[model samples]
Target: MTAFVLIAHGSKNPKFQEIVLKVAKELENKEDVKRVYVGFLMGKPSIEDAIKKAAANDDILVIVPFFIAEGSHVVQDIRRKVEEVVGNRKKVVYAKALGDHPLIVETLYQRYLEAVRE
Candidate 1:
């Protein structure tokens, strides 16, 4: 089974956490995905801990960042942290952020159409 860990920048607002957890739950329901976990760089389940937990269970681990653009957080910080924890544990795979996808454009278009209707 493959365990996917969605890493996000932490926020104090409760709603922020709620949304992240909600996304994780939705992903977990998908097939082939054994479990979907979440980790916050700044808040709970630091990157290190999350990787450790994921490494323990699944043979395939995929770490997905919840960022749009390729920034320092994705390029440097996350890489360093993952390297430290993963250390030849599980088969680690990194997924790019949700950026410039056709679905995002379609969603925006739908929103615009709704606003125009109103």
Candidate 2:
């Protein structure tokens, strides 16, 4: 089974975790995906913990950063934690941030429209 772990830069606000959970729920229903886990860089069930959980049940684990850019959080923190937890057990794949995707432009536009409509 292939499991996905979405890592986000956590916030003290409850809404941040809520958003990540909602995203994870959406991913869980997709075909070929066995499970989806949410991780926070600065909160509970951290990136390391999430990876370990995914590595436990799934043969392949995909760690996706929800960040906007490839900053230190992605380059250093996320990568380091994944490396430390998984080691050589499960096959691990690191996915790029949302900002790297072309759809992000459309998403931004939608957000703009929402603001303007309000």
Candidate 3:
């Protein structure tokens, strides 16, 4: 079972936390993924706690940054935090941000098409 830790910039607002939890719930439903845990750098259940909670087994861990760009959070902060927790684990993989994916472009295109058709 692989655990996916979705790291995002947490907000103080309760609604933002709710949204992140919703996304984690949806991702947990996917096949092959045993669990999806959401963590934040500046909010509750900080990255350290999230990692500790999920590192119970030798399951493959994948950290997905919720940032839109390869900025400081995705580069420096996340990398350092993950390295601290991962230690000698070889199954840990840090994934790219969702903004760089082609799916984002496709979604934008679909939105534009819908607007034009309206």
Candidate 4:
């Protein structure tokens, strides 16, 4: 059973946590993914905790940093955490940061149009 851990920076704003959970929930329905976990660097279900959860199965585990760019959090913090937990593991992959994707631009444009019309 592989665990997909979505890591996000903790924010005082409740909306941040809500958004992370929403993303994790959406990923839960995917096939071959045993579990989808959400964690924050600061708040409850800390990044370390999430890593531990993903390490439970001792199988493939993917850590996805929910960041807009390839900053220190994704480059440094997440890398260090993955190394600490899954030492010489079978499969541990870290996804790249979400950057300038065409889908994002299109979605933003569509949302903007709706907001203006409303």
Candidate 5:
């Protein structure tokens, strides 16, 4: 079983949390993944707590950041924090942000095509 932990920049608004949770749920439904956990950098159930909770199972863990860029949070804050919790854990893999993927470009292209059609 592989556990996936999604790290996001937590917002104060409940809607933001809801969106993050939704994404986590969707990822959990994937056939390859066994569990999904959501963690926030500045809000409730901080990254450390989430990692600790997921670490209980001895399953392979993958951490994905929801940030749009390799900003300070992704480069320094997240790296430092993840290292602290993942100490001596060889199964942990931190994935790049969604923004770095080509899917984002594809989504933007589809949006532009839709607008042109309208």
Candidate 6:
């Protein structure tokens, strides 16, 4: 089975983690997604812990950065942390940061339209 892990820069506000978890829940319902986990760089259930939990049964892990762009956390920290935890035990794939996806562009346009309408 393959698991999807969403890595995010944690926030002190509880709502931040809740939103990440909500995304994970949505992913779990996707046809190809067998499992979903959320981890943070700054808070509880750190990236290491999330990967460990995901790797326990799944043979492949797809790490998706929820960051706006490929910042230091996505470019370096995420890869280093995953390596430290899994260490080639399973196939690991990295997805582009959220902002890189075309859907984000559409979302941005929609938000802009909404702002101008109000």
- Every model's TM-score: 0.87, 0.92, 0.84, 0.86, 0.84, 0.91
RMSD of 6: 1.3
Q: List, residue by residue over 1-107, the lDDT tens digit for candidate 3.
A: 67798998888797888888898899878887778877899898798877777777546778898888899999899888877987867478899987757998898
The window of 10 residues in a row where model 5 has the poorest summed lDDT is 52-61
Q: What would the TM-score be for candidate 4 when compared with the true structure? A: 0.86
Q: Compared with the true structure, what per-residue lDDT tens digits does model 5 show for residues 1-118? A: 6678889999889899889989888887888877777789989779998888788874677888988988899878987887899877747877888774789999889999999999
For 15-34, candidate 6 gives per-residue lDDT tens digits of 99999898889888989887
Candidate 3 local lDDT, residue 23: 88
lDDT of 1: 0.84
Strongest candidate by TM-score: 2
Tens digits of per-residue lDDT for model 4, 20-101: 8988888888886667877788798888788777787647777888888899989998888778866676488888777777
Misplaced by over 4 Å in model 6 are none
| C-alpha-based local distance difference test score of model 2 | 0.86
| Model 1 spans with C-alpha error above 4 angstroms | 111-118
lDDT score at residue 6, model 4, on the 0-100 scale: 91
User: All predictions: root-mean-square deviation over Cα?
Assistant: 1.8, 1.2, 2.4, 1.8, 2.2, 1.3
lDDT pick, better of 1 and 6: 6
User: lDDT at 66 for candidate 6?
Assistant: 92
Instruction: Compose the digit string of candidate 1's lDDT tens values, residues 15-117.
Output: 8888888988898888877787788888886778888888888888888998876789888888888888887767888898778889878988999999999
Give one digit per residue, the lDDT tens place, for model 2 in 1-118: 8888899999999898988898888888888776788889899878878887888788888888989989999888998888888888778888988765779988899999999999
Worst 10 residues of 2 by lDDT: 93-102
Pairwise lDDT winner, candidates 1 and 4? 1
